[model samples]
Target: FEFIHPEFHEIVRRRLQTIIESRIVLPPVEQRLLRRDGSVVDVEVLALPFETEGGVTLQVTARDITQRRIAEAEREALEAALRQSQKLEAVGTLAGGIAHDFNNILSAIVGNTRLLLEDLSEAHPGWRSVKEIRSATHRARDLVKRLMAFSRQQESQRSAIPLAPLITEVQHMLRATIPAGIELTVRVPPDTPTILADATQIHQVLLNLCTNAWQAMPTNTGRIEISVTTLSEEAARAQSGTPLHGASHYVCIEVRDNGAGMSSETLEHIYEPFFTTKQPGEGSGLGLPVVHGIVQTHKGAIAVTSRPGEGTSFFVYLPACEAPPASFESAQRAVMRGTEQHVLYIDDEEPLVFLVQRTLERAGYRCTGEMNTARAIEIVRQAPDSFDLVITDLNMPGMSGLDVARELLMIRRDLPVVITTGYVRAPDVAAARDLGVRDVILKPDTIDELAMIVQKNLTGNR
Candidate 1:
C-alpha cells in the first residue's frame, strides 16, 4: 500500500483501517506506476489492499478480455442455432417418412373402400358395413393429413389470401364467442398484402390463440389485441431470434393478452407437443405446437413473449405475397360453368373410375374410363383427338400418373390432365404443374365438384 495523494503511510493506513472495519474491499485504482527507467507506465494498481487470515494480500488481477468475451458469445450463439436446426431437421425427416407411409396405407384403405361403396347401393344388406368403414377411414385420414402437414410432408394449397379479410373473419367469430369481460380487438391494416397459407390452418391458429387467451383470463376483465402490420427485418429478427427474413416485405400479426402470463420456463417448453400445464383431461397441449407447425408450414416464424402477471404476446411473421391475379384472370366459377367436354379418366381403382364416369356424364361430359394406366395411355395415343381432358390418379403401379400424362401430352400437346389424390406432396404438384396439368383435385371430392374444376380449366371458362 502506498501513501494517499502526497500524504504519508499513516493516513493511508488510517483509511484502510476504517474501510476494513466496515468489512468492505478497497475500490480498484487506475493509475500510472513508476517503471525502472523512472518513466510513468500505464498500470491499474489496486492500492489499500487487505489481507486474509493466512496473510495473502487481496488485490485485483486485471486482464483485458472484452474482445475475447464478444467472440466467445458469438460462437456460442451460432452453435446453439446449429443444434436447434439439426433437431428440427431430424424430427421433420422422421415425421415426414412416417407420415408418408401412414398416408399410403390410408390411401389404399380409404381409396379402395370409397371405390367399393360407389357400386354398393343403399338397399344392399352390407351397406351398413360400408358406411362404418367409410366413417372410420375418414377419421383416420384426417389424423394422417394433420400429421403430414405438421411434418411438412403434405402439399400446401397455397393461394394469395387477403389477411384483412381472414383476420376480420376470425376476430368477428371470436368476439361473438368470447365473454364481454375479456375485451377482444383486431387491428388490421386496410392494405395488408395477401399471404399464401391454407385458409383452414390460418383460421385454426387464430382460434387456438383466442381460446388460450380466454382460458388464461377465466374471470378477469382482461384485454386481448390481435394486430397485423408490416415488419422491418430488424424487428422480426429481434422477436424471432433469427435473421431469417428480409426488410423488403413481411406481414406480422401478434395476439396480445392482459391476463395471467406464463413463466419463462413454461414459455421455453410451450412449443413441445404434449407438454401441458393444465390438469389432467383439461388441455391437449397440441394447440401451440400445431400453431407452430402451421406457421412453419407457411415458411413463417413465431415467437412468444411473456412475464408472469404482466401479460403475454405471440408474434407471427409471414412473408408478404403479391396481389393475386384479378378475378377475371381466375378460372371461372365451377358452380356456374357448364362442361360438355369429354374426359379420358384413368384410375387403378375400378370403382373410382365408375363413379367418376357417372359423375361426369351426369354433368354433361362424356367420360371414357380405364383402370390401367398403360392401357389408358395406349387408348389416348390411338385416338389423340377423342378426349378433351385426361384425369388420372398420380400414383399407379408399373407407371406413375406423370408418365402417362407425359406420354399423352407427347401425342397431343393440347391435352389437359387433372390429378386426383387423397394427399399430394410438394414434388407431386410441381411435377403436375410442370406437365401443364389443368388442375390438381384433392380426393374424396363430389362428382359435381370434380366436373366444375375440370370444365373451368379445360375449357378456359374463367
Candidate 2:
C-alpha cells in the first residue's frame, strides 16, 4: 500500500477492498508503482479473492506496462506527424495552383502597365492613377510570392548571405508592423559566418518569428531580442535535441521574446497546420508550420522552448558557409535596345504573348508572337534561322517549355532559347539547362529586366 504511487493509492485500496468484501475477482486496474530507487513504473493491478484456511485473503498481481505505454505513445506521435505532413502537402498543391494562375494574370497586368507608363508623360491627367494601379499590382505580387514560399513551390535563389545586414533589414521592416509598446533589440557579432540560403526566404523566416513573438505578448509590452551566433555541430545538437548531419559549423539565429509563454501541450501542436491558440480573426495558424518547412528545405533545423509565463525562444540553425557575402547592384533603369533582332515568342496566354510582342517591339526588336505550340514548333522547324531568339512559356497545353526548347534547339543548334515561367521547379530548371537552354526567367519581369536578358542572350554573353 505504501509502495504504490500517491495518485493511485486510493484506486488500489478500493479495488482490494471490493474484492475482499465480495469474495470474488475484480477487473484489473492500471496504476503506477514507486520502486525503491524512487523511479516510477506503470503496472496493471489485478486482485483475486482466494479461498484459504482463514476467512478470505486478497492476492494482488501487477505486471509492468511501462514499456508498452512508451511504445503506444511513440506510435501515436508518429501517426500525428504523418497526418500533419499529408495536410501540408495538400495545402501546398492548392497554393501552387492558385499562385500559378494568379501570376499569369499579374504578368499581363504588369507588362501592360510598364508599357503604358513609358508611353505616357508624368504630367498626363491619368498618369498618377496608372502609377497607383501599378503600385497595387506590386503589392499583390508580393502576396503571391509569400504564397509561393508557404507552398514551397518557389525555386530558391540561394547565395552567401551575411546575417548582420539581413537581420538589420528585417528589424527595420518589423518596426513598422509591431506596436510602439514592444521594445526590439538586436545583437549580432560582426564575425558571424555567412549562410548559403535564399535571402528572401530567410527574411520571411525572421519576419514570421518576430511577428509571432510580439503577438504572444499579452500586454503588448515586452522585449524582443534578435541575435546571431556561431555554433559547432555538437552544441547545435544539444540545443536543438536533434542531430546535425553533414555540417560541422552552423549559424544560429535566435529570436527571443519576454512575453506570455506557452505550455508544453501548446508547443506540441505548434507545427500542425491550422492549429492556433489565438482568437479566430487573429491568426491562420500557418506561420510556424511555414517556418518549419522553410528550415527543412534549407537543410537546416529549428528548435523552440517555452514555459507558461517564462518566455519563448526560437533557434534557427543553418549550416554555415565560408563563402563571402553576395553583393547586390541595382538594375539599370534604361531598357537595353535591340538592333532589329527578330524574336519568336510562344505562350498559351494570348494576352501575355500580345504584351510581350508589343513590349519587345517598343524596345527596337522585331517580335513574332504565337499562341499554339505545335505551330510555333513548325515555324521554327520550317525556317530555323528566321528568328534569332526563341522565348517560350513553360507550362503549355500541348507541350512543356523544356520540350519546346529541346525541339527548337535540335532544329537550330545555334538559336538562343530562353524559357520563361510563372512557377518553376528545380528539376525543370536543371532539365532546361541540360537541353542547352540559354536562360530561364521568371514571368512578369519588368520591361528593363526583360530587355536586358534578351540583349544578354542575343549577344552570346555567357
Candidate 3:
C-alpha cells in the first residue's frame, strides 16, 4: 500500500477492500507503483479474496506493465501519424485537380492577353491596363504553380543554387510584408555551401517558416532570425536524431523566433493539415503542412523545438552540393519564327484549338486545329507527310496526347510530336519521351514561348 503511487493509493485500498468483502476476484486495474529509489513503474494490480480457515484474506498481485504501456503509446502515435498522412494525401489529390482546371482557365487568359498586347501599340491608352492584366495573370500562374507543388503534382526543377543569394531574395521579399515592429535578421556565412534544390520551392519553404514565426509573436514586437550554416552528415544525423542518406554535407537553414512558443501537445500536431493556433479568419492552417511537404519532397528534414514561453526554432537541413559554374545572362532575342511549316494541333477544347491555330499562323506557320483526336489521327494516317509537326493536348476526352503521339509515329516515324497539358504526371512524361515526343510543355504558355517551341521542334525535325 505504501509503495503505491500517491494518487492511486486510495483507489487501490478501496478495490482491495471490495475484493475481501465480496470474497471474489476483481478485474485487474492499471496503476502506477513508486519504488523506494523514487522511480515510478506502470503496473496492473489484481486483487483476489481467498477464504482460508480464518477469514477472507486478500491477495494482491502487481505485474510490471511499463514496457507494454510504452509500446501501446508508440503504436497509437504511429496510427495517428498514418491517419494524418492519408488525410494530407487526399487533400493533395483534390488540390491537384483544382489546380489543373484553374490552370486551363489561366492558359486561355494568358494566351489571349499576349495576343492583345501584341496587337496594341505602346501609345494605345489601354496598353497599360492590358499590361497590368498580364502581370496579374503572371502572379496567378505562380500561385497555381505553388498549389501544384503542394499537391505533389509538379516535378522539381533542381539546380545547384547558392544559399546566400536565395536567402537574400527571401529577406528582401519578407521586408515588404512583415510588420515594422518585428525585427528580421538574416545571417549567412560567405563560405556556406550550395544546395541542389528547386529555388522556388525552397523560397516557399523559407517564406512559410518566416511567416509562421512572425505570426507566433502576436505582440507584434519580436525578433526573428534566419541563419545558414553547414553540417556534416554525422552532425546532421545527431542533431535531427534521424539517419540521413546520400549527401555527405547538409546546409542548415534555421528560423528562430523570440515569441510566444508552443506546448508539447501543440508541437505534436503542428504538421497536421488545417491545424492552427491562430484566431478565427487569421490563417488557413496550411503553411506548416505545405512547408513539411516541400521539405520532404526536396529530400530534406525539419527539426523543430519549442516551449510554452521560450520561443521556437525550426532547423531545415538540405543536402549540400558542389558549387555550380558561374552563369551568364543571355541577351534577349526576338521570338523564333516558323518557316511556313505545316502543323496539326489537336485539343478537346475548341477555344484552345482556335487560339493555338491563330497564334501559330501569326508566327509564320501553316496551322490546322482539330478538336477530335480520332479525326486528327485519320487526317495524319491519310497523308503522313502532309504535316511537319503534330501538337496535341495531354488530357483529352478519348485518346490522350501520348496515344496520339504513338499513333502518329506509327504512320510517320519521323514526325515530331509536342504534348501540351495543364497538369502532367511523371509517368506520363516518361511515356511521352519513350514515344519520341519532342517536348512536353505546361499550359498557359506565353506567345513567345509557344512560337519558340514550335520553331525549335520544326527545326530539330528538319
Candidate 4:
C-alpha cells in the first residue's frame, strides 16, 4: 500500500516521518494513492507506533475531515465576532447612561444654584460663601454636562439651526472666557445652511477647541477661527474616509487654531475617553470624546487635522436639517411657574421640604409639607379634591412618589402632580410622565422654581 505511488511516496513519507519524529507523536495525514490504471483515490491515515521489549510495531488509520475543519473554523469566527459586538454594545450603554444621569444632575444644580444666588442678599455674611459655592458648582456642573454630551447620554432637542449664528454665539462666549492675550475670530457666512445638532453641544465643542487653542499658543499671541459651510454629502464622505453621509447634502463646521499642533500619536487617541494632556483637576480629557459622542448622536461625523509645531483644525460634519425652526427659547425649555393655590409637598429631605414650604408660603400660596409619605397620603385621602397641587419626591422608602401620585390622582383625576427625582433618566421621564406627572423636576431645583412649576400647573398655564 505504501509503495502504490512510487513517485510521491518518498515526499509524503519523509514529511510525515519528520513531523512524527520531531513531535514524538504523529497526528494524521491525507494521501492520494495513484494506481497503474491512472486513477487516484484519496486516503487518510492516523499513525501509532508501539515499541515492545524486543521489537517495534506500527499501525495507522486516517479519516477525511476537510468539511469538518471548514465548519469549525467558521463557527469559531462567528463566536469571536458575537463576543466582540456584545462587548462594544455594553461599553456604549454604560458610557451613555453615565452621561445622561450626570448631565441631569448638573443641569439641576447649575440652574437652581444660580437662582439661589440671585435670591440671596449681598449684605448677608454667608453671601460670599454661597456665591463661591454657586460658582464652583456651576463650573463643575458645566464640565460634567460637557462630558455627558460627549458620552451621548443627554437628550437633545432636534431642530434646524443656521450655522453662523451658532458659531457666533460660541465666539462670544470664548471672548469672555479666553485670556485677553488670545485673539478669536469667526468666519461663517450669515446664510450658511441649517444643520441638525444640539446648540449646547455645538457651543461646547467650539469653546473647548478655542480654549485648547489659547492654551497651546505662546504666552500672548494666537488666533482662533470658526468657519461653517454646506458640503456636498459626497465631499463629506470622502473627507471622513467613512461614508458619513450621501454624496451631496451635508453641512460642515471647522474650528481652526493657530497654536502648537499635536503630534500624530497624540492626535490618534485624542478622542478617547478620559485621555488628557492637562494637569490634575485642570481637565477631565472628555472634551474630544464628548465632541465625538455629540457628532455621532447627531448622525454626523468629526475629524481633526493637525501638523506638529504648526497648527490644528477640527472639522465636524452633520446632516443638514430640512424642517422649519422653532424659537431658541422654546427650544431650550424652562419649566413654568406653578399657581398660588393649595399645594401639598412630601419628601424625606428636611431641607428640601422646608425650602419648598418657605418658597411657596412667601409666594402667597397655601403650602403644606409632610416628611412621612404615609401621612401625606392620608391627608390626600381625606380630601384629594382639597389640594390643587402635589409635589413629591421619588424613591421614598415606604410609598414611592409615583405610588403617592397614583393614589392621589385616583381620587381626583384633575389633581396636578409633579415628580422630583435626582436619579431620573430619559426612560424614567416617560414612565413618570405617563403616571400623571404633569411635570418632572430634576433635583437641586430652586425653591422658587419648584413653586413656579406647581403654580403653573394649578393655574393651567405654563
Candidate 5:
C-alpha cells in the first residue's frame, strides 16, 4: 500500500466532503486508510445513520480488503497487457502482408530501371533520370526491409563485421539528417573485435538510435556522440541492470545525447509498443521496439538511461567474434559476358521475367522466359540438355521456385539452378541450399548481378 500512495490525507478529505454534501445514506465504498505506523491500506466502509436526542449520528464499519484489491489490480494489469499484445500482433501481420506485395512491386520497378540503365550510356540524356529512379527504388526497398524486420519476416544475413568502418559509414549518412547545430561524434577503436551480425540490421539499429536522439532534442541544437568499445565480462555486467549471462566477449556501442531527458514515468514505459511522447504524425513509437527486436535477433542486449533536463544514453551490446572483419568494397566490375549458352528463367511476375530476359540477352546469352511453372518443367523434361542453367523466382503460385528447381534437377541431375526472390527467410535459404541450389539472388538485383550469376553457373564456377 505504501508503494501505491504514501499519503492519504487529501484523499480522505475529498471522500468525506462528497459524502457530507449529499447527506444521504450510501452503500459500501472503497477507501484508503492510514494505519498507526503510517502505512496505507485499502478498506471497504459501510456507514449507518440513527437519530439521537438532538441530532443525527452516523456509525461506520471498516473492512480490510487490501488483498482483494491487490488481486483485482493485478488481474486488470494482466488484461491490459493481453490486449496490447493482441493489438501489436495484428499490426505485425498486416505490415508483413503489405511488405510482401510491396516488395514484389518494387522488384519490378528496380529490375526495369536497371535494364534501362544497361542500354543507355552515361552520355545519354536520360541516364541521370534513370539513375535517380533506381536510387529512389533502392531507398523504397530499404524501407520495405525495415517493415519486414519489424514484422519478423525478413531474413538477416549475418557475418563478421568491423564496428569502426560500419559506424563511419552510418555517421556520414546521418550528417545529412541531423541539423547543422547538432555536433555528432563517433569514436571506434581500430582494434575493436568484429561481431557476427547482420550488417544492414546493425545499420538500422544505429540509425534508429541516432534518429531518436535527434528527435529528443526538439530544438535540433544539441550534441550527440557515438562510441564503440570492447568490454570485459566485469565491465559489461556492470553496465547492464539485467543479468548478463554466458558471454565472455562483448562489443558495446553507445549513443549519448545532451538533450531534454525523459521523466521517470516516461522511462518506465519507453519500450512499450505504441507509447510515444511525440505529437501526432511525429512518431509511430515503433523505433525503440524495432531496435530491441533487431538486437535480440543478433543475440545482443540494449539498455537506456535518462533524467529530466539531463540527457539520454542508449547502450547496445553484441557478442564479439575473434575472426577478422569482412571488408566491403564498391567498384565497377567488368560486365560479365556470356557465350551463346542457353538459359531458362521462370517467374510468375511477367514484368520481372521480361526484364531479366532482355538483360541476359544483352549479355550475349540465349534466354527463354516462362511465366508458368508447369510449362517450364515440360520444357526441361522434353529436352534435359536444352538449357545450360535454370533461374527461377522462389515465391510463385502453385509451384515455388524450389519445386521447379527440384523437377529440373530430376530431369538432369547435374543441372545448376539459382533462386531469385523479393523476400527471403533463413529457413527458405537453407532448404534451397539442401536442394543443391547454386545460388540465391535477392530481387531488384542489378543486371550485372544477374549476368554474373548466370555466367558463373554456366561456366561451372558455383
Candidate 6:
C-alpha cells in the first residue's frame, strides 16, 4: 500500500515481510500513515499471514486513530499545566511565610537604627555605618515586596498617574544603579494619557526590565531606551502581539536594549518564577515573574521579543485613562512629638513589643507593651479611658489584632486603634476600616511613618 510518509514505508515493509516469512501474526503497533491526498494520519496497524487457494497471502489491518492521538496529546498538555500551577502555588505560600517573619525582624532593626541615628550627629564615625545599615534594611524590604508581589499577596494602591513623571523618576534612580558603560534614555510624549495604576508596582516593573537589559550585556556596555507612545487596541495587537484590551486606547511602554539578546529557548521560560539563566547567586530568577505579576495587577499585558545578537525589547501595555493625572505635591509633614498621651501596644513577638514600646517612649508617648493578647484586652478593660491609642500586630496566637481591636473599640467607641501587619491587603484594610479601626499600617515602617500614623489617628486626622 502507498504511504503519504514514504520514509516509514521501508520500516513497515521489513516488519511485514518478517511476519509473512514466519507465518505469524504481529500485534498491533501505532504508526503514522500517508493517504492518497498527501495527508498524514495516525493509525494502529497489524500484519498477519493467511493460507488461501492462491497460496500464502499477507493480510494487513489498519485502524485510524488520529482523534485518539490528538485527545492523548491534549490530556498531557493539561496535566503539565496543572502541575506547573501547583508548583507555583507551593512556592508562593512559602514566600509569603518567609516575608511575614522577616518583616517583623526587620522592623525592630530598622526602628532601632532610626533611633540610633537620631542620637548621633552626621559627623559621628558610627553615623555612616548606621545609615548604611538602614539602607540595607530598605533593600531587604524591597525584596520582600517583590516576593509578596510574585505571590499575589501584595495589594496595589491604584491612582491616576502621569506616565512621564514616573518614568523620569525611575530614570533618575537607575542612573546610580546602572553601570557607567550603559547609557539610559527616556522618551515620553506630553500627550500620553494618564493610567490608573500603583505607582510603586509600576516603578518596580520598569526597574526590573531596565536592570535585566543592563545585565544582558557582558561588559555592562549597552544603550537602554525607555519610550512611551499611545496606541489603539488594534495597533497595539499588531505591533507587539499584545492582546486586545477592553479599553479604547493603551499606553505602550517599551524598554529596548541593544545588548546580547536571548535565544528562542531561553525566551520561552524567562517569565517562569525561579527559572534563571544567570550564574548562581547572581539573581533570584523572580524579577521577570514579579514584573509579570505587577503588570497583571494593573490590568496590563507584557510582550517580549529577542534574538541572539539583535538584542531584546519588552513591550508593556497599560490601559489609558482620560482623567487628568492626580497632583502629588509634596507637603512637609511635621514630626509629631507625642504629648503625655498613653498608648497600648501588643504583639506576640516580645522583641517586637519591646522595640515598639522603646521607640514610642523615645518619641514622648507612654507605651504599655504586652505580648499576650488576653492580657492586652484585660489592660484595656481595666482602664478603658487611660490609653489614647492602641497599636496591635494583626497575626497573633489566641486572638488576632482584629479581635483585639474590636474588643477595645467596644470598651471605648472613640479609641483610636491601629492594626499593623507585615502583609497589606486591600480587602483587609477595607474590612478593618469598617470595623472602626483608626488605621492600618504595614510593618517594617520607619519610626517617622509609625509616629505619623499614630499622631494622625489620635489627633482625629485621617
Q: Each candidate's root-mean-square deviation in Å?
A: 12.6, 6.4, 6.0, 10.5, 5.6, 6.1
- Estimate the lDDT of model 6: 0.83
- Enumerate clash totals for all models, in the order shown: 1, 0, 0, 18, 0, 1
- CA lDDT of each prediction against the hidden true structure: 0.71, 0.84, 0.84, 0.70, 0.80, 0.83
What tens digits encode model 5's per-residue C-alpha lDDT throughout 1-462?
A: 343244656664565565666666777877777777868778887776666786556687889998998899889867766776687679777876576567668877876787788689999999999999988887777666666665666777788888887788679889987899999999988788999988779988999999989988978899999998899766887886546665688899999999999999998888876678998668767789878888887778899989988999999999888877654213225545788899998988787778778878877899999999999999999999888998898888999888998888888989999997766767778989998998877665533367777877887886
Candidate 3 structure quality by residue, lDDT tens digits, 170-252: 89878999899999999999988889988779989999999998888888889999998899999998897767878999989
Report the C-alpha displacement of residue 17, candidate 3, in angstroms: 3.2
Off by over 4 Å in 1: 1-153, 172-181, 238-241, 325-330, 333-341, 346-385, 393-416, 425-439, 443-462
lDDT of 5: 0.80
Tens-place lDDT per residue, model 2, 1-462, is 778999987777777777788787777888889999999999998877878999887777889998999999989857765776788789888887776678789888887888888889999998999899887886677666666766677787788888887788789879998999999999999888899898778889999999999999888899999988899989988888877877889988999999999999999999987678999668767789878988998889999989999899999999998888754224335546888999999999888888888989888999999999999999988988789999998888889889889889889888999998877677888999899998887666533267877888898985
Report how far residue 69 has shifted in candidate 2, in Å: 2.0
Instruction: Give the number of the best model, judged by lDDT.
Output: 2
TM-score computed on alpha carbons, candidate 4: 0.55
- Could you tell me how far off, in angstroms, the CA of residue 141 lies in candidate 6 after the best superposition? 0.7
lDDT (tens digit, per residue) of candidate 1 on 211-236:
88877885757999999988666767
| Lowest lDDT block of 10, candidate 1 | 325-334
Candidate 2: which stretches are off by over 4 Å? 17-27, 36-39, 158-197, 225-257, 260-330, 446-448
TM-score of each: 0.52, 0.74, 0.77, 0.55, 0.73, 0.75
By TM-score, the candidates rank as 3, 6, 2, 5, 4, 1
Highest TM-score among the candidates is held by which one? 3
Q: Model 6, 1-462: lDDT tens per residue? A: 577267777778778778877887777888888887888888898877888998778777889998998899889856766776687789887887787788898998888888898799999999999999988887777668766765677776577899887789789879998899999989999889999887778888999999899999998888999999999878977886656677888899999999999999999999987678898668767789989887886778899989999899999999888888764223114556889789889889888888788888877899999998998899988999899989998888899888998888888899888888888767778889999997777778634367776777888987
